[model samples]
Target: MGVEWVKKSFLVILMMLLAFTMSACGNTSKAVQKTEDGKVIVDFWYALGGNLGEAVTQMVDEFNASQDKVHVNAVYQGSYEESLTQLRQLAGTSNAPAVVQVFEVGTKYMIESGYIEPMQTFIDKDKFDLSQLEENILSYYKVDGKLYSMPFNTSNAIMVYNKDMFKQAGLDPENPPRTFSEVSAAAKKIRSHFGTNVHGFSVVTHGWFTEQMIANQGGLYVDNNNGRSGEPTATSINGEEGQRWFKWLHEMKQDGTLGDYGRAWDDHRAAFLGETVAMYLDSTASLAGTVTNAEFEVGTAFLPTADGMDPQGVIVGGASIWMMTDIPKETQNAAWEFIKFTAKPEVQAKWAANTGYFPITKAAYDQDVLKDRYNEYPQFLTAVQQLQNTSVTPATQGALIGVFPEAREKVVNAVESIHGGADPIEAINKAAEEINAELENYKRVNQK
Candidate 1:
């Protein structure tokens, strides 16, 4: 009986040891991986795919080859929304990536999540030079006079026009419309000359365009100075600027000038590429794709402003690189090194040339490579000039609310409602009401 009991105990101990080994093997996926050469591996999860993804991979490879202390593994985690969801899922876990590229709208939520190590933390610790950064681009990521993230790829909304269509309509292809009134006039001419199959203006009823228009007028989207001062309590989108903006869209739709592309930004791009739209508002980052896809001469300009108001600026649209907390000190330091390397003027110039995103450092514009590239394609310089012209005001600083992404969807809904013949003011007011309620609930739940 004693021998039989010993045999049973030995078998149980062996099974437990096997289970332990399997568990250890399952946890090999880590943010910072180590190589056989004992070099620290830093996993970088990014949102870009396709050509943009290829550019990022090249940058990562160059970064890896340039140094032996750290190896950055760039992982494509799908879209920005998907990447943010994955990051949230991995919070407080060992599986989180050491670094992430978060979009502009996700700024407030990322800050509230408390899972990131502010860039200021490292900048202060290492006494990094912040003076070399682009002041306008960096200002968007700042909260209370402090930068929380490192600007990576920054872009602005620009007007992409079909130059051939402009010539056909007898409008000056060299001078695109600079105001909403001028846009309407040009669209009218385009429609009149080219008939119904061609659209004068096409845009994805995206809240982004609306936001850009408001910023151009030096207006705010949410109260509390576009959420820069404190926690935003209410949305001011239904105010004068928003009303006039939506009214223009409604009138354009009524006049058969503005063609609705629903909420899909890609559809608007396709329309432009297909030569179905004369002018559209899209990100400067899409310039490369626009130039590649369109057979006609494509022209780029700053987003049109309201008739009376001078253009203040368009809000920068793009993501910035953020470091996660709970990572090893060594890993954090290594990640900072990679970020700094990427921020170098030459590196940024190459990235801008490849991805069509404006370089985030002013010095990048001074590089001969970037200069030559800009000379060849002067359309690239429109956004650069716009960014330089834009001042860092609270309204232009961009809205920072924990519920901004959701609120933007509501704004889209409002725009769609207006396109569907709903009263612009009423639709905007209703959307604002819904957004304000959501913000209140969010504050209560998050205890912010």
Candidate 2:
């Protein structure tokens, strides 16, 4: 969920490759492992940290313990970008991990370079029911209509509110804001009710909010072939809608209703968890860890939309399990078994229940365990509904620049300009221009 934990990390790694490189859900990580002796060791590199990292390690440990045929060694790669560079460098050599968690945006590059193996082959060979996975999730990693990766922990944007602040503001805690006006109004109400003790809404003045606003308004994030990764060129998103969204945030930040970025991603979460902010826009996967530790009762709602526009469109955000090429078939098959095992409905339900990420398979949703979860945790259902209603529109397919993550950093820079009172349209345009330059360089250097 969010920007894709491993994805953004590995993207930085790739960014570090040139400049250098650069670069989820759930309460639980379910491991339905089988033990088969005298097999092989499969290396997995992940970029997640803290609880998410621990959960991943736990899953890997269980997977390893489950079978004698495979020993999956889990390693912590720096970030999405770092991992990507490692993957690229390891290529044509012998350092590639058997499995790497790549961001959704990197799907095309992996698919195109033929560095990663397709999941369909793994699926066919394993004989798992591919039908168990939701079509939208499956399509996320599909390029030219072929399944190239397997969806694992999936998440989407959701509104998180502080119940104490809501109650103090005389608003219904159970009914958090569902529209943009409501978001603004509620934030104002909370600010007045709590004085400077609490802020209403929090977001980094960066490309993240831009993407969220654009998606909610149904604006295309990229052009060409559904914004699939291998598109011929990068498109500019510095137009009217992007301007309006960034401008609004600029205003909010000025008015103090909006919050700023802390040191790291978790710092933002910590900001909310610390109760300095009343509402937060973040990955739905945070529910598992956040709710348990939050001082105030927590509430979650669908991401709010502007008036007159349906607030329904959502983009799939998270990393997928990618199998490597140029590896042994035994290792590939072993990796496939692990992947298939993880995708099973029973496994999916357990993982969903444990972690805040939505289960990628249908059986997980249909299971009695998940039914109980839906009844118990309404937030999970909200994410599920948004994801299921998802359309593979270009806007929702997400951007695919060669140095896409770097381009996003440029977007953050543009927003920083706005925070300093720079013109919103001009700032975005400048950012877009900078991004295009990076895009061109990537295309030229990584040209097929």
Candidate 3:
């Protein structure tokens, strides 16, 4: 009887132990997802929405179908700011994505965050030929002589005008404004011809336009070579170039030729489409949509500079793909494979054609897809020419400050104030002072 009881107890104990072991193994497998064939799974978190999001998902599907080694799981995480905020909370945890798309203004913050692996590391390991990419676009992502991220969707500010309206106003349709004074004059003429029913010009009261305007005139947004050389101690937006920009808008407002569309991009674009505004400043990314939706003929031109100054060119405004550091090396490699796939000429061509962003890869221009797109929408070529003509300088390479997003808000506030009859100099000076204080605080916290 005692022997039978001992045997029953031993069997029960052994079954419980086996059950626990099996459960542990199942939990470990759940930590990192994999395909049935044991391919590495990479998590890609992107911030693009609407058609752009669909495009990203399509690319991921194509990549998955093309390869058997890696599977990419694309996740949309909201807007640029929201995505970054989520990353801040999830970083250094297993819940973090292997790759993320960060905007241009987030460059300094991402570099200092210590949460990402420099793209140069992978480039060196794989002997990647960066020369195949566009040099001007690449310059924006290179910092401290190293490439921090891979440029994906790139764009520059351009002037989109109503060619029909220009003719009606007795202005040269072929000769759009090339200087601030020219734009002001043209705006007045446009308003005069159309009367109070339409405004001559409008730009969304966003700081990005202000940045591009300042940079186009060879002006620095901050000291220390726009923070490329070292940390920026102060903002230079109150300088001569910035003052010219603010003053230009002020004069137009006084003349009642400028449309106040607030800060919403949609509102400004709607105004242009609705024929409430004759000309407007917008990103190249809007070219395709605006051209497709507009009833009147659309003309694209380079952003205007000050009266006598030659245009230095506009800064690239878009996002780049970043690889995270906390993930396993295998997953990181998988992320790299996806990144390389995104840069392929065929893939980039498709992306560019579907969206208005410039393909970072130079070879994409040679692809039939992109060529067809350019042929279909000739206005798209203006953005390409503008970027190619841009002089690679400290100003044009764009500013690098950890507080860039915040600083942009300050600039927008200054613009609103100036339009509301505030003194341009005083409004600009106030913004600069606020940005300087923020920069000092950022430096203090980030100091090693």
lDDT of 2 by residue, 1-448 (tens): 7669889999888766764221111111212233355557777888777777887787777777776678887899887778888888875335667788987667767776667778878666657676768877776676666688888777878777888778888999888887767888888888888787678888644466667678777776556643564454654477666776767766676777876654265777888988778888788777777777887778887777776777546777778989877666767777887887778787788778877888888878778877887787665676787777776666666655556577668888887776677877788888878877776787788765
TM-scores of the candidates in the order shown = 0.92, 0.85, 0.93
Whole-model Cα lDDT per candidate?
Answer: 0.87, 0.73, 0.92
Worst 10 residues of 2 by lDDT: 21-30
Q: Single out the weakest 10-residue window by summed lDDT for candidate 3.
A: 23-32
10 residues in a row with least lDDT, candidate 1: 23-32
Question: Model 2, which residues run further than 4 Å from truth?
Answer: 1-37, 124-128, 229-232, 368-376
Q: Using alpha carbons, what is the TM-score of model 2?
A: 0.85
In model 2, state the lDDT of residue 405.
74
Model 1 residue 165 distance off true place after TM-score fit, in angstroms: 1.3
Q: In candidate 1, residue 182 scores what lDDT?
A: 94
* Model 1, span 167-228: residue lDDT tens: 98899999999988999999999999999988899778777888888888888988888888
* Count of clashes in candidate 1: 0
What is the alpha-carbon RMSD of candidate 2 to the true structure? 10.8
Colliding pairs, model 1: none
RMSD of each: 5.7, 10.8, 7.5
